[model samples]
Target: MQTTCACHPLTMENRASAAIIVRLTGEYRVPHDLILTILTVMLGATALVAICHRLGLSSIVGYLATGLLLGPYLLGILHESETIHWLAELGVVLLMFTIGLEFSLPRLLASRQLVLGLGGAQVATVTLLFGAALAVAFGIDWSLAIILGGAFAMSSTAVSLKQLGEQNELATTHGRVSTAILLFQDLAAVPFLVLLPLLGEQAGGIGHVLLFTLMKAAVVFVLLAWTGRSLLPRVLHWVAESHSLELFMLTVLAMALTAASVSMLAGLSATLGAFMAGMMLGETHFRHQIEADIRPFRDLMLGIFFISIGMQLDPAVLYQQLIPILLVIISLTLIKGLVMWLLIRGFGYQKSIAARSAIVLAQGGEFGLLLVSQVISIRSDEAGLLQPVLAGLIISMLLAPLLLRNNETLANFLMHSGDKDDAKNAIDNGAQGDDDFRDHVVILGYGRLGRGIARVLIENNIETLAIDSDPRLVRELRLQGEPVLFGDASNPGLLQQARIDQARAAAITFDDFEHARRVIAQIRRFNEQLPVMLSHPADHDDCEIGDDNVIVFDSEMESALMFARQLLVVAGVETSAADLAVNSVRSHDYSELRGVGDED
Candidate 1:
């Protein structure tokens, strides 16, 4: 005991920690390098996103840039790790689930004209155009042409959803139309995924195999749907009654992955299965909770998915095919955007909706990437041609957000370019705002913090419009004669109803980080000049650049700094020294929260 005890102070505990680490790194063959890669990827993403935010771009762009910077095409810090791929796959699954969660049977039925009709026409038209051009112009194989064309016909769902959700435009007329078209694309992807091998083979009947797969998938879907309709709600209800959050999360994941696995076993895409699972889960009362719980996973996975996409663009290869890449990008964007615009307008939407929706859905989608990958896997001989198209598709996705961000300007230009009638609303009743609200503040979240903010505003004789998701909270607030509404601030309709455009300022005092982000984002989209205050503790790198406009009340950071200053004062530090020490702590806290500018 004496020999090992005090000589090294904590030698035994330190030895044990080292022993465990060695065991993890060496004994059981753990993926230490993979862990390192993940940490770096996150750090790199944070930095890139901070920079991109400062540049007034979406965070999705930063994730893509991170992949390119660290991928094999560049520094090669993390090269094609299977872990990253797995994360990307999970992200896609989560994305599908979210889409399903947001959309329901009733909503879908209401939008059938766009989802099935306009969406179908766009996909078919674009595929035919691209395929015919390739087969005729380049004389490529008909099979390869079909695969590539179908891929190009699809638009990036991840990019579209992120951008639209950020702007809280998913409920707008244009947003609805674009969303429906995307849903069709998601469903349409299944056939292409199955048909690639069938079309590529020289076998007796690839069609037979595809038919068999579809039959199996249909049977599986029906069975899962039936089970969902009958047993899922009860299961979720029982779990909810138990009040075990961890258990509930586990059950949700199990059900989703299980259904997805069954679908994969039945020869359909796992992503499709996840969508089905979400549809089934959407029927439960726990849908909102599930949506909230799965958000963090969805976001992390989405970042990884985007990073994987970025990794595909090798600068050298892209430069070699620069001309072809540019041609493909222009053609895809122009053709697809035009088709979407015309199709949307033909469906009775306004010219504004039609034009913006067209630009929004014009890019090559994630489903397109899926088809391209499947074809390449089945027939590697086409990789050379497919790679260039892949680059073009990714470039389009990167540009899609920018196009959407400035859609109003672009749509206005289109209106003034020749057709001014489109600029005028078909109906005056479309205006949703309260016309009399001038110099009012909009408050999101009616929690304790929100109530405080509202009270303070009212005391100052400032009018306020408040929104909260909790029905009970809204009822209570209304009984107290507070100007609070039972609405989701993340909904663009509510923001419009609150007259955000005419508001003097806005405050988001909610613990729900995701919802807060959406509220801020919607505000940004609605009135980029508006001053908004977000009452969240998270130092989200993506929102750091807008700190001035999107003010964050970081109470924790302030409290810590205060504590440090007090400690210094108590330790007999002079008043000036204490102030200096407090300032240093505050600055350090801020630096910890934000990033150093473009740290090379």
Candidate 2:
């Protein structure tokens, strides 16, 4: 006891015991509680998405906010796992590939002048102007300024296309112009990929690095083009013949990944390689099928990528830099919109078209994030300054959907004083009067089957007016010199707009039986004598509607039986056997055939 008096009353043992108790208490907390937190965050996001959809705002903003709330910066429900990042990267690749698949040679050729000329000039001029300004104002070097300017030159193709499609304006003069600009931006990303490595320090000189990069990119492009044209078609055909969906999906994924890897090894961006592969595949007959297969994966991955972007928000930094970020956003949107509008209008488009195009492209693109990341990776010294810029770009993208949704109302209000005639012109441009053609067939639904009929009818020199629910399809057909009206086929207003009273015959080309039935009912009520023809779905039971005035074409069953009979005949089967093959397919699917007389 006398010896203990010399020692301190509190020992390390007591302190250690207290610390262990606290740690244990924290560790033993209910792990299952996290599931509830995650569900709450997801539920909140779903509600937000629904609200935004109702308001015509971009659902992407809702998704991003959902991610931020659940992210470590906020509620901390979603941890930044390595698994998520890898999957997000794959999503970016697939997204670019899907874009390539949609990019057809004929479409590109149709818009080549705009894409290569106006689009090219817009990028070069804006990049040079903005780059120089940033270099002068911010005291940044030319290299960093150049990178920033290039990033700003790009608009989010995904956001623009989606919004345009929603508005049913993608086939308008403005939509086409916006598309061309986006296409140019995508192609320009290739050069930035080559330039990124040059920004890094290497064993070689700058000139040597540049030369080597150019050579490598050229070689890779040539190899991919050759392989895609010469070998990929054969491989796809073989895979298709297997009739295995899983195998087909696997083959596509493998091809995309392989191409990406090859491009990376050749000193180019993996995204660029994936895009090139998609472009090559677009030339093949299986493009549509491949697109359908890859779509689900691409959409999932893209959502993950957006979530990753949301996770990058640092609360402390965001709070501190809020004012500057807002300023940057305002300046970027205004300047970009003004420049694009002026440029597009100068290219002979109407003022309304030009304004819409500008609004759609005002937001910064996802590629800007990639460019900023590349810059930070190469030059760590500039990371501090670029952080706010990156944050501002993301914020702009977040606000873009909302702005675009209200763009029409906003543009009309703002430009009313300056150009009153523009609004009238836009309306006039959109209108399709019935007096324009005689003896023309009016087609309801511009889907695959509708399109097939339109093609054959057009080939036979019969004028056709196509009515579709999809605004995008209507706009596209109108742009191509066809009369197309966007409205519900069953609506009397739409029928009148399509000149159903004066039309010789109306073809209900929709695949959905319910929708076809509605349209047929509507048509019969409008004109009892008008001939109504419908294309039946594959699994449809042959049933008639009205009297001889109504006709139902079982295209699906007819095609199937025709093919089966032909196969039997080629196999040296007797006439009886061929008839049996045809009858078998028809009996199972088309036995209840009756015409409009059965439509009580």
Candidate 3:
């Protein structure tokens, strides 16, 4: 009876095992649900990014916070693994590649003094000073200290540039200086990346490691440069001729990934290779087209990268080291600001511009995280120690947008007294006395097109008053003995300052359509009979120009006429006919053509 019971139990166990195997096979049939979940998370993250942008915060911070909230430590919607890590790494590679495309060699060469000289000095000085401080204060070894200092030496190129662009300051004196310094920081990141492996090495020979790394980097650079110069242009030209956007995009991605892999295999930073590849292609005619095409992918991947950064942050670690993190943030900001101020001032910039430049570049950058990760990879035992530094970097990045948002306010406060004096002197130096300024033409916006219009008017003996929002441009124009007001064109007070009521004709030379419309409406409200002419960029298609009360000249109209003339010339048409056609279009005489029927 005992034997019979044992045999029956064995048969039941075998049947259960067979049933379990069948269920497992069914589960492995497809992975549709896993892919759907990932897509859902990505879309949710993107939505959060948009919401954050609407709320006036950096979208990067939003994406990162979203990732953290949904990650394993929080709601557990997503889990960290090798696959996710690999995707995050790809995001970074693509980001660096896109940045490289923007970095042209000629542009760097043109600003070498400011970029390489001041920028390089700032990085070196801040690195040395902070590194020494960390070593003495925390009793840390030189290698870790150097890594920390190098991390702090970088500033967020994305944050600074975005803010400057929003304020239309990229073309201003302060913007140029900031850009030059940031460019240097970008190039300096290459060496710092190479040095990371050497820092954590057990071997005592730092020189040998560095030499090998440099040699590898040099080889990668030469390879990428040669391929880009000799082959990429032809490939792009052929792609363009075929007009296959899909093929072009695929080719770009393949090239970027291949170059990155080559750099990695060569024992160098993949970012360095990607950047070099971008720089090489930046010389081609298809650069802008490539930029436009790659933007969507870059933006998506960059968002993912930022989110991954947030998800990696352990809240427990952050909370425990809050005070120390804050201290590092403050110290890093102050030290970097001081170094930048001195460097920019040494370059002969005014105190206000220099100070602004300092504020813009005072934060830690994204590459700092990459450098720390690289270091950790080489020395796995020290991984836990990087937690505080990573926390500090995140805090600094979060604070960067806030500091930059208030840069204009800070600059104005610092330069208020000097600017007032300059304005008074400007008014005193004007040729027209307060009594002789009636019936003058008020031109809003002193940009390139506006200035050209002003010149033509001046040559015709017309007295003109120009109003521009950019303080630097206004100052320069005043120094050149021109009458320009330093204020917003849409401001009613500024219009009154320019004697708009007494002006016989007004010109809205601003490129922004909304600003032009506002200025025109305000002028009409102030002076009903003033003929207002507006300027536009070449791409603006729907410009409303009709109204007996106002005379508007859309700049696109002129560009269209010029383009037509060029096409006619290219088709072997006579120059006289082309000129006649262009003149007719410019004067709006198309209605007088013999075959043209008037629908209205």
Clashes of 3: 0
lDDT to native, each model: 0.75, 0.75, 0.74
lDDT of 1 by residue, 1-600 (tens): 355554655588899998899888786775788789878988999999999778656677788889889998898986776777788888878877766666577656766776788889988888888898988987777667777888988987777876887775765667767777888887777667656556555556656776787787788889889988888767866766665668877888888888778877876778767888888877544555677667777888888888887786678868898888888898888877887777777888877878888888878877776576556556777666777887887788778878888876798787665454543442233433322365799888778777788789899999898877665556566677676655457766557656788799998877766767777877877798888887665455543534467777775667677887788889999878999877875767677545544464
Residue 236 alpha-carbon offset, candidate 1, angstroms? 0.8
lDDT per residue (tens digit) for residues 1-600 in model 3: 354543444478898998899899977777876887687787778788788788666777677787777777787777766776777777777777777876777766766787788888888888898889878987767777887788888888877887886665665667777877787777777777767777656547766777788888888888899998999767766665554568877888888888888899888877777787788777754454466567778777777777777776777877887787777788768767877788788887777777778888888887877776566656666655676777788778788878788875675676574464332322223233322356789998888877988899889998888877564566567678788765557666557657787898988877677778788877876688888877664333456745576655646556767888999999999999999878976576443332333243
* lDDT for 171 (candidate 2): 49
The residue pairs that clash in candidate 2, if any, are: 544-594, 544-595, 545-595, 545-596, 545-599, 546-596, 546-597
Candidate 2 accuracy as lDDT: 0.75
Model 2 spans with C-alpha error above 4 angstroms = 1-48, 202-204, 373-381, 412-420, 424-600
Candidates in order, TM-scores: namely: 0.67, 0.68, 0.67
Better of 1 and 3 by lDDT: 1
All candidates: CA RMSD in angstroms? 13.3, 13.8, 14.1
Better of 1 and 2 by TM-score: 2
> Cα miss at 387, model 3 (Å)?
1.8
lDDT of 3: 0.74
